[model samples]
Target chain A: MANIETSLKEAMTIDGAIGVALVDYTSGLTLGTLGGGTTMDMNIAAAGNTDVVRAKLRTLEMLGFSDGIEDILITLDSQYHLIRLLAGSQGLFLYLSLSKSRANLGLARHQLRKIEAELEI
Target chain B: MTSGSDPYQSVRDELAALRQQLTGVRGCVIAGVDGLLILHDSITGFEPHDVAALSAGAYGISRTTGSVLGQGAFSEVTIRSKDGYLAVYAVGELALLAVIGDSGSNIARLHLEARPVTQRLAEKLAIETSHPFG
Candidate 1:
């Protein structure tokens, strides 16, 4: 099983990986993080993303539907933000922020799935 | 609070379990639509109140997003950060589950696991509200 730290390191190796962190959406805290530099602030970014996760969950409830959320994708001019909720770990999720210039959305998604499968936590 | 027969109990229990399961997760909380705390299992620096407030904020954003898109309703929302990600899913009319994780977490799988529980809770709420005995 891949430990959280190793998983994070592997995630960084992805072509466009700028920074990575393991966050708890419920509390808006990062359990682990890697790669963000002067250009980005991982803490602030994690906190804000917490809001996005909460909003979508709220919307799902109000709609009176029972389906689950798969993943959330945000496309910016220079970045692709991907949020993948972890299965079996209720209230937990994975957040990936990639540089559009170097990341492949399709491949990133695929790789994330592979990592999730091997992740112990 | 309803009596022993309260149908909302199931929903509450489910949320509690979710909180427990995510014991290692930081900055995550399960809350009700009214911003009341249902469960808080944060492993980071945030307070329970802060998590609740963030959940409320997400609810507001979701409402606005629904309006703009002309969609009948909103389901889930996600925000990405340079170092982490936040995601929220609607469990039922009475509850919402929010998660904050690092960029390495698998959000997609989280959603899949949460969906069934949310659906079950919603049904229990519906039945309890619909029946006088409940």
Candidate 2:
């Protein structure tokens, strides 16, 4: 039953977590956000990531498969962007932006999962 | 709205049924290629419309990557998170089925259950488009 604000704060605590948001993949909207400043805009990041999610879903339909999205990861030169869909919550997702230099991919994924489990909405 | 005469009725019905079959899954949504919701079953706190849009966006990116790599087409895509996973499967050429769940969920089982539903929907769409009475 943890609120989104709590979740966002917890996500920031992860080593190297630069910013995080609970984004609506459908509308490309940031439902909640924390961290990220100056050079990074959580809203823009969420909107741009919408394309990433849409592209993967489209490719699957063209190929004629039956399945659903689990999570999406984009690795940049100096950063890592993670888009994780909320299980049982249709259009909600957690958009995590982390610095590659300081973030542990494995641990970040683990923490995201934990946060998802505890996330109330 | 034409009752039995509506060509998309059967297909829509099938999708609804598929939604039920996937009831145990977390954050699952059935949406059209345009990202419009066809059917969805999510936890109380989730928003189906938002997920559908994200699914559409993800599908779009995947298509571009496929073209760039010279891949023929994509059937499915999975993104693994630290604590869970997001999976999107194609149901015919115009629809997508997305699921978000814990890493511990039986992905193999989910895929198996969704396969027949996808195939059936594809066939139904093909028949409707090809037959006048369908």
Best by TM-score: 1
Docking class of 1: incorrect
DockQ of 1: 0.04
Writing each residue's lDDT as its tens digit, candidate 1 over A1-121 gives: 7988998898888889988777787556677878888888776677667667777887998998777777889999999988877776466567889999999999998888777677777
Which stretches in model 2 have alpha-carbon errors above 4 Å? B1-134
Give per-model TM-scores: 0.48, 0.47
lDDT of 1 by residue, B1-134 (tens): 34676445656666556545442334556677667766655336667766666776787789688989898565677776776667776767666677776665445444544677668766765666567754
Judged by DockQ, which candidate is best?
Answer: 1
True contacts kept of each: 0.00, 0.00
- Stretches of model 1 off by over 4 angstroms after superposition: B1-134
